[model samples]
Target: MKALQLSAPKQWEQIEIDEPSPPGPGEALVRIHRVGVCGTDLGGYLGKFPFFSYPRIPGHELGVEVVAVGEGVENVKVGDRCSVEPYINCQKCYSCERGLTNCCESHQTLGVMCDGGLTEKMILPARKLHPANNLSYEQSALVETLAIGCHAIDRAHVTEKDTVLVIGSGPIGLSAIEFARVAGARVIVADLSQTRLDFVTEKMGMTDTIQFDGSEADIEKLEAMTDGRRADVVVDATGNHHSMRRAMEMAAFGGRVVYVGITQQDLQFPHAPFLHRRELTILASRNALTGDFARIIQLIESGVIDTDPWITHHAKFEEVIESFPAWTDPESGVVKAVIHIS
Candidate 1:
């Protein structure tokens, strides 16, 4: 089988490798159709993602078709099109036992911790596959990214009366905005890129936008938008540390803040006044649960969520290596790039 392997930092090579065998018990054989490229994959290419190692298959966001099934596989069968939950968890862990499989004590994420779906075919546990019969292959591939937004919104328990501020206009940030709107919250978006902010306002029906100038005036603008009160629910989808720190101060008193982005720096916050006085509820949202996947599929089917403009770039498997660098450049206007594998 042919696969794109990250041989080292800033290096990608398409190479032939041995094909995975038939699915074992409780697993299914799946043929890769679409692979969504995200920051993590780009981080791997730049050797910036934490704990990422080289020679990785470099894909987790997948839309696939089942080719065959092993014994005891029941969730899906041959010919079913599905989206994969690439986060593998140990069912015996305390977190998993509590139905918090996204943060299992021992989590192995595909494409990061192990081999992933950038290849032509692979065997995956049947339970990780979510049926997406009503979705196109590109939309199915987006389920994973969209699921992150669903999980974050689920964590915050957003309500109609709340004012939600999403501090990024990237794919993940856009996902947060989408679900926040579904939750009936008044949505506000902030980003350094005017192009992304315009897209959010024009494409997603978001009217409030904050073009971040890295000044206190930005917060003032947010306060003005909310009638002197900050956002009731703030989601930090920009993994940059400065933005993450700013998110803490952007929430209103007694508001909820969800950190959906990951940063490597040691983040510091004032304890006595800011966080402590506000009585804020801070949450760290990880990968999505199985229910999130099901809900996202339903949202897509019901036409509540649209991913049309979200996908701004596409490439064939053979073209990915050469085309990837341009996607990394902010000027390329890449929102979500999906590679067709078959």
Candidate 2:
């Protein structure tokens, strides 16, 4: 088996290894089919994503098939195409006992904390799977990414009547916009690039965009977009500390702000202005639950999720190590890159 491994930051190489053995007692051997390159993966590549370890296979957005099932694996079996949950939690933890395993005290994600599905085969715990009915490899790989947005929306509790402002036009931000739209919030997205804004407008029918770098009246611009009242909910998808700080300044009075982005530096914000005015600020980590994954699959299968515009590029597994680096460069317009393993 050949795996694309990130030995160090800015260094990804393809190394040949023997095919993994059969599944263990509670594990299943997934024949990895599709791997989605997300901002999370890009962050890991650039040495920015937290909780990442080197010499890792950084692909958790998986589209898989059960080539072999473990001894007691009854939920899925051979020939079953599936999407992985990626979240590994300590089932005995207090949070897990309360059915809120997203905050599991001993939780570790596949790509972030352990070997992930960047190779031809991966031995995964059977519990970390959601059945993929008829979805293609590329589409199946997207479920996990979309689920992140779903989980964020769940945390924000976005409603139909709210006016939403989303910062960043990256894949996660776009996914956030989609979920917000489905939740019935009128959304306006801000980004530094017009090309990316055009992508949202032309392909996704989102006409509202704020040019972040071009305008000095950015706060005023966002204020105008929300009819001078500012946004009811503000989400920062740009992991940059500056962008997140700016997002705090852009929220409406008594509005909610969800920080889906993460950075190493401690976040800075004005003290009295942030809290005294009654802003509900939240940090939305990677906490997509099984319910969100199920909902995303339903939305995609039901035609509610238009994934046609989401998938921008695809390459064979053999080309992964070569093409992965290019996807990190924004000028390449790699909105969503998929690696086909089979």
**Candidate that would win on lDDT:** 1
Task: Give candidate 1 regions above 4 Å deviation.
Answer: none
**Can you write out model 1's per-residue Cα lDDT over 1-342, one digit (the tens) per residue?**
899999888888888989889889999999999999998888888888886887888899999999999999889989999999999999998899999999989998999989898999999999999999889989999999999998999899999999999998888898898899999999999999999988888888788999998899999999999999999999999988888888879999999989998889878888767689999999999988989898999999999998898898999999998999888888899999999999
In order of appearance, the predictions have TM-scores of: 0.98, 0.96
Candidate 2: list runs displaced more than 4 Å: 214-216
List the pairs of residues colliding in candidate 2. none
In model 2, the number of clashes is 0
Candidate number achieving the greatest TM-score relative to the actual structure:
1
Once model 2 is optimally superposed onto the true structure by TM-score, how far is the C-alpha of residue 247 displaced, in angstroms?
1.1
